[model samples]
Target: MELEQFEHTIRKLFNKELLEELDDDYGFTNKSRGSFKTVGYSTNLSLETIESAAENNVELMVTHHDAWDFIYGLKEECLKKLKEYNISHFWIHGPLDFVEFGTCTSLMNVIGIDRVTKYSIYDNGDVPGVGEFNEPIDFNVLVKRMRDELEEPVRMWKNNEKQVKKVGVLTGAGHSSNYIKMALEDGCDTYITGEATLYTIQYAQFAGINLLVGSHTFTEIYGVESLAKKIQELNTAIKIVKLKEDHFELNH
Candidate 1:
C-alpha cells in the first residue's frame, strides 16, 4: 500500500534491471494517503486521462508509456490535476512490452498461435518481443483474426496472395517499411501493427508482404490490461480502472 511497497512489487515482477534501463519513474509519488485503494491505468500521461483518474477518485495512475522525458506540452496541465487530487503517477514502459504477457505476446495469444518465438529487438539488441506463427493462414483470414482479437476494424494493405505462415506483431506505430523488411527477411508473410503511412502501403505491395494496420490506441490496450489483471490477482484489495478513449475513425 505504501509507495515503496507498490514500486517494490512492480520492480520484482517486471525486473529491476529492465526498469532502470528504460528509466521508468514514479511520475508523481507524493501523497498523504497511507495506502492506495484504486489504480487508474492508461497508455499516456495526458491531461484527459489524468482528469479522468481524479474524477474517479483513483489514488494512483499508471501509464504504460512515459513521455515526460521527451514531451512536455501536457505535463503542466496533467500535473495540476494529479497534484490537486493527491494521486500518484507511475510509468511502466519497456518492461511491460515483452513480459510473459506483454503487448506483442498478448496480441499473438488473442489472434491464436500454436507456438511463439520472440523477434523484435529493443534497448541495444534486447528482444523486446515479436511472435512467430507456425501455421500458414490466408492473408484475408489473418486480417480478420487481428480484427477479431482487437474487437475493432483494421485498415489493411494486401499485396500478393501469399498465405501468411510467419506473422510479426509490433503493437503500436510499427508500420514502417523497415519492420516489413525485417519480417520479409525472417520469412514473415504478414506484418501486424497499429498505424501505417501512405508510403508503406505501396512498399508492402512491391515487397509481397501483407499488413494489418489499426488505430494506435486500439492496438495498445492489451498490455496495460494484462498488467492490471496480474496486479489485481496479487493484491485483491486495490481497484484497478482502465481509462480509455473511444475509438476515433477517420475516412476520406
Candidate 2:
C-alpha cells in the first residue's frame, strides 16, 4: 500500500481531531518509501530498531517515540542511515497515549485492570488511566504478572498491605507526585508507571498507595504493537515486523 494511504488510515484510526488537540509529533519523519510491502514497529526509534527494520527488509518503520537525542542534534547519523536504507520512519507519540488501544490502556489490560473509573488530566485532555480489577489480588501477584508480561524487572514501593483492586497506570515517564495524588483521589490502592522519582516514591508512601514501576520501553511497547496489528488488519497485503530492543540493558 502507499505510505500516504497508510498514514491517513492510522491518523483516522487514532482520531485526527484528538491528534491535533494533543499536538502530537506524528506522521512520517522520512518519506522514502512511496509504497511499502512490509512495515516495522517498535517503541522507540533507536539505532538498533532502525538496523533491525533494515535487516527485516521493512520499507516503513513505525515507532512510538522519536530519537529524543534529536534535541541535542544527535540523530543526524540515524536519519542518514534511514535515508540510506530508503526506510520511511513514522512516529505517533502523545496521541497513542490516550487512544482507545493506547499505551496506558494496553498496560492496564496486561496487568488485569478492568473498568476504567477515573481519569488523569494532561495537556491534551482527561486520560483514562485509573481502573479497577474484577477482584482484588495480592500485590506480589500483580508484581509477578507485570514482570512476566513486560519482561522487565519490577520495582515496588510497598506503602500499604491492601489487596490491589483499584489501579492507576500511566506508561512511559508518567510517575509524578501529581499523578499519584490523582490516583489516590480516585481511590486506587495500586499505581503503576514506567519509572519513578524520589519525590514520587515519597508521595505514594505518604499517600498510602502501592507503587509499581517498570522500564519505559517495555511498558510502552504494547501500544506500538497494537498499532502495528491494527495497520496489518486494515491492509492485509502489507506484512508487519516487530523490532525489539532491550533498552534497560547495562552492557554497551
Candidate 3:
C-alpha cells in the first residue's frame, strides 16, 4: 500500500481530525517524546539513515510522539521526511490514552478486570483511570495475577491490606498523585499505574490505598501494538512495525 494511503486509512479509523480538533496542540509539549533516535539525546543515526529509509521504499511510519508539537515543528518536518522516503506517518499520542476502549481498557482486559467507572475532578478525567473488578480478589492474588497475565514483574507501593473490589488504573506515569484523591473519593481500594515516583509510593501508603506500577512502556505499548497487529491481520497488503522502543525510565 502507498504510504499516504495507509495514513489516510489510519486517520479515518482513529478519527484523526477530531483528535486534532479536541487538542489544538495535540497535547504537544517539550517533554521527552519517546526514544526515537531522531528525538532522544543520544541519536545515533544521521541524514544518511533518512536516505537509506527512503531508498528502501518504506511505506508507513508509526510514532509514539504526536506530530503536532510547536517546538518540534512536527507536521511540516514529519511530512517532509516521510515524503522524501515515500513513507506516511500515523501518530497516536494523547488519543491513545483518552480513547474509551484504548490503552487503559486493554490493560483492564488483560488483567480480567471489568465494570470501569470514571472520575473527573478539577477538570481532569479519563475512562480507564478508575474501575472495579467483576468480583473481589485478595490483594496478594491480584498482584500475582497481574504479574502473570502481563508477563512483567509488578512493583507494589503499599502492602496487601484489603480485598480489591474497586480499583483505578492509569497507564504510564505515576499519575497517581493527580488521580489518587479522586480515586479515593470514588471509593477505590487500590490504584494501578505503569510507573510510580517515590513520593507517589509514599502517597499511596498514606492514602490507605494499594498501588502498583507495572513498568511504563510495558503498559502503554499494549494498545497501539495490538492495533498494529489487528490492522496487519485484516489487510495483508500493508506492513506493520511495532517500534521496539522504550523512552521512559522508571526505577523500581
Best candidate per TM-score, number? 2
lDDT, candidates in the order shown: 0.72, 0.83, 0.58
User: Which regions of candidate 1 deviate over 4 angstroms?
Assistant: 24-34, 67-72, 123-128, 132-134, 249-252
Looking at candidate 3, the ten consecutive residues that score lowest on lDDT are: 35-44
Q: Which stretches of candidate 3 lie over 4 Å from their true place?
A: 15-18, 22-58, 66-88, 119-128, 233-236, 245-252
The candidate with the higher TM-score, 1 or 2, is 2
Residue-pair clashes per prediction, in order, are 0, 0, 0
| Candidate with better lDDT, 1 vs 3 | 1
TM-score of 1: 0.86
Q: Which residue pairs clash in candidate 3? A: none
Evaluation by lDDT, superior candidate among 2 and 3: 2
> Residue 191 deviation, candidate 3, in Å?
0.9
Q: If both were scored by TM-score, which would come out higher, candidate 2 or candidate 3?
A: 2
Q: Total clashes, candidate 1?
A: 0
Q: How many Å off is the CA of 127 in candidate 3?
A: 6.6
TM-score of each: 0.86, 0.93, 0.68
lDDT per residue, candidate 3, 196-248, as tens digits? 77777878888899987787666766666655655565456655544434333
Give lDDT tens digits, candidate 1, residues 23-106: 643334335465798988887777778778888888888877654645756666666667888888877766767567777777
Clash list (residue pairs), candidate 2: none
